[model samples]
Target: MRDSLRFYLGDELREIRDVDPTLTVLDWLRLSERRLGTKEGCAEGDCGACTVVVGRLTEDSQGGKSVRYEAVNACIRFLATLDGCQLLTVEHLKGPDGALHPVQRALVEHHGSQCGFCTPGFVMSLFALYLNEDRPDERRIDDALAGNLCRCTGYAPIVQAARAMHDLGDRTADRFNDRAATAARLKALADEEILSVGSGDRRFLAPATSAQLAELLLGHPDATIVAGSTDVGLWVTKFQRVLSIVLYTGRVTELRRVADTGDALEIGAGATYSEAAPAIAALYPDFGELIRRIGAEQVRNMGTIGGNIANGSPIGDTPPALIAAGAALRLRRGDATRTLPLEEFFLAYGKQDRRPDEFVEAVILPKPAPGARFRAYKIAKRFDQDISAVCGAFRLSLDESGNVAGIRIAFGGMAGVPKRAAGAEAALIGQPWSEASVHAAMAALKADFTPLSDWRASAGYRAEVAANLLLRFHVETTDPATETRLVGDRRLAHA
Candidate 1:
């Protein structure tokens, strides 16, 4: 067991001890390290002004370790979570001779900065993109920079900078390009020991394995388990809630696996949305599209599917989609484990069916049959980086006669929980897949949920949008080429 938190900040090895468990990465960077490159915009995960790239050792198919760089919101990310990883800030981008990196040079050349407060974040985000992809299209560029919001200089120049970064020079041949050494350092840091930092009520523990996590959870039942810290980070930044015990699940190896077991897709609870996206998109395209709109690229990189379900938020985007797909939850408590239907896990607002010692291990999504039609839609105020007002997911299976043999409907933001529309499903099952049947199901939706009004939308608007989303699902499934979405298809007519 180790009490000290060890990670690499730029090229320097840092061994930290006796620090507050809830200390955010942004604070540690700016205050402790005295680096002023990473700025704080919203203090929450919304604004990308605090964006920084993290490099973690990832094992490939051949059992070789390589560094995987991802941009994350430093303002919300806890400092304790940086154990066994490499932290890179905007200051680490310049060459040894003080020459600007390709990402920074491109931004300067394209006039991507105005007031320059948000420029560091934009550089880090684009640097991550530049490292990962050889060339990013319009969609990829938009997705990469979606988390960052610049009030002074519009996104047009930033978009141009992202497009022009690759053309500057050889992006891969840089100082941090020595993946083998970085991976070796990371591997050496992964000692497979339980990290217990801090004492008493204020504590942070990161277990290296699932068994260790299970034992720790059993010991400290009240400890808050955090996988990605996407939502939990807000409790400290926005709500200013002082967490007593924080048990981080990022180091638990088994919890990060994503596999297809022939029958169903088994996504480990710790798998980030970015890690699980390809497999999910392969199974259902529309569901993947909804994930793309979850909270921009930075959020997707840090947010986990299990955390999304375990948090039990009424507006969580994945729950409705997973419920519609007939997903199952695998939970663990010490040596004991159990499986339950995904919809049954959520009981009410801010309440889940999970015991304090029990943690969600995996989510099993059953593959739909050949005759199944699946669709998911999210109605939010803005197109990106916004919470959902109404999220609807549908799956319908037709028999030989084209009648609804079996159907499942789930919705979020319409009730206290991410619930299945039992009334709506009952109305559609055994009925023909036609316009009249869909209308009947839409009417039955009112009986299933009485949505509450909030600033994002009114109750009446929620009701109307929920019903129309169902109708839209019907229209989409009935006609293959309906062109229902307004913004999905993007093509550059002329530069």
Candidate 2:
């Protein structure tokens, strides 16, 4: 077992030891390294002021190692998660000649910064985009900047800078372009040893393999499992809770994989939304749209579906959609593994069916049937970076005679758990696809859930929106001439 953590801080390898288990990457950057560029606006992951790029080693088609860079909220990210990866901050963007990086240059040229509080975060986000995409559209630009909020300057200038990046031409020859050397360094640092750091009861363990993780969990069942720190980070920052033993799943390479098995799509428990978006989109397009609005690019890049499921938050955007689509979860403890329906995993509000010493292994989603029609709707105050007030997902199949063959309806934020609307499903089954049947199911929703009123929405509002979403889904699916979606309306107008 390695007793210390090693990672790259902009081409320089640093080894860390005897650090607090709950120490955040942002704190270490400003306090220890004295790199003051990354600022902390919200200690939670909501704000992008502390945005930084993390690069992990990935294999290319030719079996050559390359680095995949992703923008993450450093304020919520733990320092221990940086082991065997490259950390790129705002200060690392300059060339050897002190020339500003293309993203930095574009921001300056476009006047994207004012008061300069959020500039570094924006620059880091743009840098990740610059590395991944040659030219990004307005939608992509907007998605990248969604987590970042500029109070003084509007998003117009920042968006201008995002587009201006494409005008800089080919950037493969840039100073930070080459990943071969960094990949090699990271690969050398990678090992099967468990990285155990910190003192006494307060420690962080990052197991390198799934087997190791299972064994560690079996031994230390009380340890908090942190994948992305998108949620757990808040325990320390907002709640001021000190985690004693944190078993990080970020280093378990097997858990980060996404696989297609013909019968089902298997998304590893630690796979980020960014990694699983394509597969989820392929299975259900509406789910893809819902995932896009989960928490902007930064949150999506870091948050995992497994973490979302394991956390068991009723309002979590993915649970309702996953539950409605008949997704199952693979749970692991020691060498034993068990599969359970996703809906059954949530027992109540702030409680899950997960047992001690067990952790989520993967989410298995069966391929949609031939006649399946799936739709997921997320209703929130803001279109981006906002929690859902109510999330509804519907999967309906029609028989040869145009009757409702099978229907699965689920909702989040309507009750204590992300649960299926059993009463509503019963109302729709074997019924003709008509307004009368839709109304019956809509009425049945009231029987299934007695929603609680909160700041995001009232019970009456949620109940009404839930019913309206069903109506909207029916109209879009049944009526060929009717366009209920705004996007569809625009397309029809253009046509």
How many steric overlaps are in each model, in order? 0, 0
Query: Candidate 1: which stretches are off by over 4 Å?
Result: 483-495
Q: Where is the poorest 10-residue window by lDDT in model 1?
A: 486-495
**Every candidate's CA RMSD:** 2.5, 2.1
lDDT of each: 0.90, 0.89
After superposition, which runs of candidate 2 have C-alpha atoms over 4 Å from their true positions? 59-64, 481-484, 487-495
* Per-residue alpha-carbon lDDT of candidate 1 for residues 1-495, written as tens digits (9 for 90 to 100): 899999999989999988788899999999998889999999989889999999997767676778999999999899999999999999999888999999999999999999999999999999999988999998899999999999999999999999999999676786777788899999989988999788676889999999999999999999988988898999999999999899999998788888889989999999999988889978887788889899978899999999999999999999999999999999999999999999999988999989999999999998877868788888887888999999999988888998999988999999999999899889988999999999999999899889999998999999999899889888877875663444445421100
